[model samples]
Target chain A: MQQKLTVSQLTKYIKQLFSYDNLLSNVCVTGEISNFKLHSSGHMYFTLKDEHSVIKCVMFKTYNRRLRFKPEDGLKVIIRGYVSIYEAGGSYQLYPEYMEPDGLGDLYLAFEQLKQKLEREGLFSAEYKKRIPFLPARIGVITSPTGAVIRDIMNVLFRRFPNVVLKIFPVMVQGEGAGKQISRALDMINKARAADVIILARGGGSLEELWPFNEEILARSIFKSEIPVISAVGHETDFSISDFVADLRAPTPSAAAELVVPEKDALKRHIMDARIRLKRALAGKIQREKQFLAQLSKSPSLRHPLDKINQLRIDLEQLNKRIENAMERKLESAASRFSVAFGKMDALNPLNVLSRGYSIARSSGKKIIKSVSDVKKDDMIEITITDGSLMCSVTDVMPGT
Target chain B: MDEVKSFEDAVNQLEKIVELLEKGDIPLEESLELFQKGVALSNYCARKLDETEKKIIKLIEENGELKEENFGQEAQ
Candidate 1:
C-alpha cells in the first residue's frame, strides 16, 4: 500500500497549504514603476520594483480609465491590491485598483493629485462657476485674525470701497486640525447667512504650511457653498485644492477683497455722471417744451383769427352802406316818376282846357242860335264851363236855316 | 472692510433709492425724502469705514476668558 488517501483528504491538504502560505495577498507596497505598458484593449500592465523585490501588477480597463495622470516607468508609486493566483500561470500577482504619485511633498503631491482628479471630473469648469456679485453687501472672511492676511485685506477693502461689511470667522489657518476647523467655520458662516460673498484666505507659506487648505473636506465645503467663494491662499505661484473648488481665485487676500466689493470712488463717479446726464435730459425736455410754446404762439389761427373777423366786419359795413345808398336812390326815383304822371294827368284835364279859353257858348242862352231863328219863343239856356257850374233854364228852341 | 450689523438693509435701501431716482417718476415730495434717506445711508457707510481704524488689539484667552488687548496708540 502506497499511503492510500481519500480525495477529500487530498483536497483538504492542498487548501490548508495555500491558506497558511502567507507569501501572497492583501499587501501595501511602495516602489518605482518599470516595464509599464498600456494595451490597446484597454488594460494596463506594470511591474512594481524595489531594490531587491519586484511584483507584477494589472489594472483592468475600468480602473485604468479613472487614473488622474499617466503612469510612466521610474515614477515612484504607492499601490494597494490583493494578491491573487493567476489561474492560468498558477502565479501570484497584484491587481491594483488605485495608485498615487510618490516622492512629492505630502501636501504638494496631494494637491496636484487632487487637482488633476477634480479637473478630470469637471468640478472647476467655467460653466459651473457663479459670477461674483457686482456689489456685495456683506463679505465673510475665514483666516487667522492675527495674521497679516486679514490686515492686508482690510486695508485694501477700506481703501477701495469703504462700504462693504466684513464678518470675520476667525479660525486656525495652519497646523493639524486646520482643515476640520476651516470646514466648521465655513459651515457656521453658511448657516448664519452672514455674508453674500466669502473670502477663504491665508498668507503665503510652505507646502506643509498650506496643506490644510488642500484638504478634501475643505474643498468639498467650498464646492457646496451657496455664497460665492474666492480662494486667496498663499502667493500667486502657490495653488491649492481650495483654489480649484472655489468660485474664484485671487492672488492674495487683499486682491480677494478687491474682487468682492466694488470701489466706492468709481461708483460715485458713475452716479455723478448719471446725474449730469439726467439734468441735461431734463433741460433738453424743457427747451423742447419752450419751443413748442413759441410755435403755438406763432400759429396763424391764434394770431390772425381776430384779424379775419375784423376784416369780415369791415366788409359787412361796406355792404350795409351800399344797400342804404341804393335804397335811397330807388325811393327818390319812384317819387319823381309819380310826380311826372301827376303832371301829365293834369295837362289832360278839362279844367285846364277851360283855363286855356277853349269853351263854346250855347243859345241863351239860346238867343244865339244859328239863324237867330226865332226869338219868338221865350228860350231858357243852361251853360256848363270847366271853372264853375252854371244853371240856366232854356225857354227857346234853336232853328236851323 | 468694516463690520456692520445690518449691511444688507443699508445696501438694499441704497439700491431702492437708486432705482426710484432712476425711474424718474417720483413725486417731488418723495424725491426729497428718498434723497435724505440716501444721504443718511451714505454717511452711515462712511462712518463704518472710519470706525475700523488701525487698533492693535490683542485677544487674550487666559483661563478661557477672552479679553481685548488694546494697543497704546490710537490709529487715525
Candidate 2:
C-alpha cells in the first residue's frame, strides 16, 4: 500500500523540481497565443498552444513592461522564460522573461509593428506633412554636438544661405538612452519655441547604431512637434521611422542644409531680376500710353481739322459750275424759241405784204379813196407803195358803202 | 498691398506686381503705384538678404532651462 501526499506538499515538490532542471529554468517556447488577458495587477495570463498541446503561461508585470508590442490572442510569438510550477494551484506554467513576434527579429519586429500601428493612425499620410517655413529666421538642428554631421550641415548652410540663424540641439545619436534624449530635445526645442524648422540628422552606421531613430517614442515626438521637421538620418540607403514621420527627408545632413535654405547668390539674382522687371514693366506701361496718345492724334476727326471744310468748299464750287451750265442751257432754249416766233411774225408783217407789190390811196386826212365820189371836194390824197409814198391833189370827195 | 512681413512675402508680392504689370492693361496711375511698391519690396528683400550674418548657434542646458550659445568654435 502507498501513502498519499497532501496537495500543497506535492505541488511544492514539483515546483522545486522545475526550478532545478536547467532546460526548464531557461527555455524558449514558440507557439500561437490564446486566452490572453492582462490582470489589474499587471500580470499577463495567456496560453501558448500548438496543434496538439497547450501550455498555460503568465508573464509578470516586470517582464511585460519591456514589450514593444502588446500581446494578443491568436498572435504567434516566440517567448524566452522559465517553466515553473505554481505551488498554490498545483499547475505548471511558463513565466516569460521576454516575448517577441515569431517571424522577425525583436527590434525589426518592433519597428514593423509600430510602423503598422502608426500608419494605421495616419501619421505617414501626405496631408500630415508640414510646410517648411520660407526664409525661416531660426532653423533648429538636432544631432550630435560633435560629429561630421553638424560641421557638414553648417558648411552647406553657410554656402547656400547667408542671412539666417542655425540653432543646433545636440543629442546622443545612438545607444540605449539616445531615443529619450532626442525626444527630450524635441520637447525642449518645442517648449521654448526656439526654432522655426528642425533638422534631425545622423551619419550611417549598422542597424543598431541607427536603432534610436526607429524608436516609436522618437517617431511620436517628431510627429507631435508643431515645428516642421526634416529628418536626415544615415546615408541614402538607410531609412528610419523618423524619416517617415518627419515633414521632409534628406539623403544626408549636408543635403538637408542645402535644401533648407535658398542659395544666396541665386536669391540676389532673383531680387535683381524682379527689380529689372519692375523697371521694364513701368517703362512698357508708359510706352503703351504714349502710343495711345499717338493713336488718338492719328484718329480721323482730330487728325486733320481742315479736311472737312476743304471737302465742303470743293463741293460748293462744283455745285456753282453746275448752276451756271443749267442757266446757259435755259438761255439757249429761250433764244431759239424766240427766233422761231419772230420768223412767224415776219411772215405776218404788214410791210412784207406791201413788199408783194400791193399799193394804197389816201386823202389828206389819210382816208383811203375806194369809190368815185370819195374825192369830189378839195382833199389832199397820197399813194403808197412798198418802198415810197406819192402825194396827189383831189378835187372831190368819194363815198362808198 | 500689405507690409512686407518676410523675404518670402516680399518676393511673392513683388512677383504679383510684376505679373500685374505684365498684363499691360492697368491704368497709368495704378501701374505707377504698383511699380513703386514693387521696387520698394525688391529693395526690402535685398536688404534682408544683406542683413543676415552667417550665424550658427547651439542649445545647452544650464540647470533645467535651455539656452543658446555660439556653435562650438572648433571648426569656426
In the order shown, the candidates' DockQ scores are: 0.09, 0.62
Per-residue lDDT tens digits for candidate 2, residues A1-401, read 78899988788888888899999999999999999999999999999999999999999999999887778898899999999988767789999999998986667767777888889999999999998887877899989988698889888888788668988888899998899889889988998899999999999998789989998889989999999999999999988899999999999899999888888899899889989988998899999899999999999878888999999999999999899999999999999999999999988886787799877888677887676666666566788989999887766554546
Q: Candidate 2: which docking quality band? A: medium
- The Cα local distance difference test for each model comes to 0.72, 0.88
Put down candidate 1 lDDT per residue, B7-55, tens digits, no spaces.
Answer: 4455556666666665656655566566666666656654444444332
Best by DockQ: 2
Worst 10 residues of 2 chain B by lDDT: B52-61
Which ranges of candidate 2 are over 4 A from the true structure? A1-4, A298-401, B74-76
Cα lDDT of model 2 by residue, B9-60, tens digit: 8999999999999888999999999999998998899888878666788887
Question: Against the true structure, what is model 2's DockQ?
Answer: 0.62
Number of the top lDDT candidate:
2
What's chain A's TM-score in each predicted model? 0.56, 0.73
